[model samples]
Target: MMSISSRFAVGIHILSLIEFNKDGISSSEYLAESVNTNPALIRKIIGMLKKAGLVEVHPGIAGTKLARQLSDITLLDVYKAVNVVQKHELFSVHENSNIKCVVGRNIQDTIIPILSTAQSALEKVLENVTIEDIVKDITEKENLDKRHS
Candidate 1:
């Protein structure tokens, strides 16, 4: 089975870091350190987020910022911004099945609705969850960890 791209998680990480360090720089290099990846990859994902209007990137500047408030940005927004799925499809049906076989001919038709319904359900959950929600969860978890420490 195919899995979602890592870009989606990295995109969220970038936004969360921007919010956490609002007063400081959020350059690709800084984000790369946190993500444990290369600056070029971070920049590529940031460019996608900027094009989606989720972030504002200033040329020759040392940092980037959120284009909208955290409450207004949802997981779905970041998912689309980073092109996590091609053509918004979470599942891909196998092609070139032999039409001579009954199962091959009917399989695509039989599973399309199920896949569509599943995708819709997943998207609904994503839509309801905003970046603010994630940040709050992170803050709570961090506080809990500190208490334990």
Candidate 2:
């Protein structure tokens, strides 16, 4: 049932953790603990992030760090890195129900425009959100909650 793979949530987890620490060097093992997943899985996720130019991993001695300013990074940027977008539409409905039914014969044609418009609107909404905005929101909430407690 799941079409798109949402690794953005995971990427955000890694990025948000990085944002919290100014200069704390983190290894894949540390990230693995935070994510409660295998080190190899975390390493793979980190590799993706690196490939997307979101983070820098130092070999030999130093650890991984954010490559770009968090504010400069968009949610879309991170999402695109990990998301496996469905090449085709979510639902098929390709098979013609019955030509004699009249309604069935024309349903696909009738729904195409509606479906296209809906898809465009959805994309526009997604474009409106950025990772910087999300992290800022997270900061505000954490600050507020901490003050209360």
What lDDT does each candidate get?
0.93, 0.75
Highest lDDT among the candidates is held by which one? 1
Q: Stretches of candidate 1 above 4 Å error? A: 98-105
In the range 1-149, model 1's lDDT, one tens digit per residue, is 66899999999999999999999999999999999999999999999999999999989998999999999999999988999886536788898899999999899999988998889888889999999999999999999999999
Candidate 1 has its poorest 10 consecutive residues by lDDT at: 84-93
Q: How far out, in Å, is residue 115 in model 1?
A: 0.8
Q: Cα RMSD (Å) per model?
A: 1.7, 3.3
The lowest-lDDT stretch of 10 consecutive residues in candidate 2 is: 83-92
- Candidate 1, 73: how far from true, in Å? 0.5
Give per-residue CA lDDT, model 2, range 1-149, as digits (tens). Answer: 55556466888888878777657878878887888888788778778889999999865655578899877777667766765543235445577578888898899888877777776576566667766777789899999999999
